[model samples]
Target: MSKYWSEAIQSLTPYVPGEQPKGSNIIKLNTNENPFPPSPMVLEAIHQFDTDRLRLYPDPDASALKLSLAEHFNVKANQVFVGNGSDEVLAHTFMAFFRQPQPLLMPDISYSFYDVYCNLYGIEAKHIPLQDNFCIVLDDYAQANGGIIFANPNAPTGRALTLEKIEALLQRNTETVVVVDEAYVDFGAQTAINLVDKYPNLLVIQTLSKSRSLAGMRVGFAIGSAELIEGLERVKNSFNSYPLDMLAQATAIAAIKDNDYFVETTQQIITMREWTNQQLQSLGFKIIPSKTNFVFASHRYIEAAELMGFLRTNQILVRHFSRPGINNHLRITIGTEAEMQAMIDCLKRHPDIISL
Candidate 1:
């Protein structure tokens, strides 16, 4: 809207992040952040970081973090890339592989930021609609495309495609890059990381935000062929060299190394997600089969926005997207056991909901 803006900026429709309430009283099941704190190892590492290191620039390649991720995922250091967050990693991805003469293909109801990135980069996008059940069918992407990307245990819907399905797509689509955004993969879904060595065109991007409880830290990484990693590095160096700082690198290494804590916390969310689904279904809500740390549900009678308002008034927050096809559904992040019980108990006691 400014006269000084570039043509790309002028035409862009930006992504809107979930609301972060200012108060401490609300049960925040809106943003899909972990209900638990990060691993003790990560916290200890942060506390022990030397302050004097701030005077020196961080490794431009984030070599230490990459090596840690490489070890954790059983990939080589040369095949990994790190960034300030997955959002940045995704932005760099769109710039590097998706901007092409042919349109990039993605699910119509997947991550909203994909659209923003496409607009920002002037990349043509073809939205392949999800089935009536809200699951992606890769066969729909048979048309020619510059590249392909979609979330596994997809956002908002929380439905995941099995690794078998993903590998099937990779087998047929050998000419273009396939990026699987696995931000929520740890909760219950199988990761496509294991298939990377077999499919050189596959790139699996994951973050510490959801399962590792590191949203505050803003770290994300990608695993792929060394050649693909090099392409991302070329694009990253042209944009920002110091994407991950020293403290971020240190803490990320600690988080990745704490395999036991990572497994324990993600299992906790998975257990709570199933319980929440049962609770919602008992209340006459149609719950989608979810593989992530959240559930997507629609009440049989109550409208989504109205239910969101009702929850908000009671000091609870969940996400509701007003877009078509999914406007009736609410995406609720799985909180602690007590938080989930409190939300269900509130609905049980409220006269308006009880009467319905």
Candidate 2:
């Protein structure tokens, strides 16, 4: 540790993103990215971007993108806040609303980023353990806290909470902020965006990375009451005023407007996810009921790490978290139909994997 670094930086643990292999031929299903390419209209918008606009800073407020998102989500423009990515939006959120006298609460096995954000901001976090089935239990979150946050259709496990349950949490926790990170919501779970107006304390965070096929562009947003959004804006302006560049703004606007393309692509991923789940179950894997674009499963005979290695040897990559409680589980992203078939073929060849 360097002495020159700030005390916060010296003690902070950063979030480790999924591996991005450089090889082109490998089948990548580790990160929850859409297998299909982004819409042609998005590419064309990027191409048609005015080069001269780069000379000037983009709108610090990103008015156009915010307007488009507001219209698309049926919210007021003031209620929407855009940032570099959902991670960034979430970071600003933890710093702004989650720090209070009582500790912030989250599911112990939910997105690892929640812990990272807590560490980064010096926010006290009370981690509520997931239910025996790996589901988030709303009752566990009833304890005193500064704020509550968790991924809907949570990461790794991919199990989703119904909108009714989310509303129940909101109904109970009216004093503190409830942040719903819906990065994978478009794939399966119902969004809490509709409830934002009713609950002034509810904040819903979303990303273009998984559903819009814009992970490369790094655009994310939050929908809440204008007051909640203002808090995030304060943190953002203090950090970086021009988080979205000219091209990113142009590309995101086009991507959000291309409703037909986004719907078709996400539907395809959902279809592939169902197929993958069936195939995994047929291979004797104990599958968690997943609503996200990925499946969390463990085989009866094969261990998670060994199964990962076998998939890697076949040039197919899936995610396996080497941590407490879930060391034997694998989180496999739903790739294209062809990629899933190839993965099944590879699994069939491994005798260690028992087919049910």
lDDT (C-alpha, whole model) for all candidates: 0.91, 0.92
lDDT of 1 by residue, 1-356 (tens): 89899877887788999999998989998999899998999989988988888999988877778888898889999989899889999999999999889999999999899999999999999999999999999989878999999999898899999888999899899999999999999988899999888998899999999988999888999999988888999999999889888888888899889999999988988999889999889898999899999999998988989888888899999999989999999999999999999888876765566987
lDDT of 2 by residue, 1-356 (tens): 99899978988888899899998989998998888887888999989988988999899999999999999999999999999999999999999998899999998898998999889888989989998899899988998999999999898899999999999999999999999999999998899999999999999999999899999999999999999999999999999999999988889999999999999999988888888988888888999988888899998878999999999999999999998889899999888899999998899888765433
Candidate 2, residue 98: the lDDT equals 89
TM-score of 2: 0.98
**Runs of candidate 1 exceeding 4 Å displacement:** 350-352
Native-vs-model 1 lDDT? 0.91
lDDT of 2 at 328: 96
For all predictions, the C-alpha RMSD in Å is: 1.0, 1.1
lDDT of 1 at 43: 84
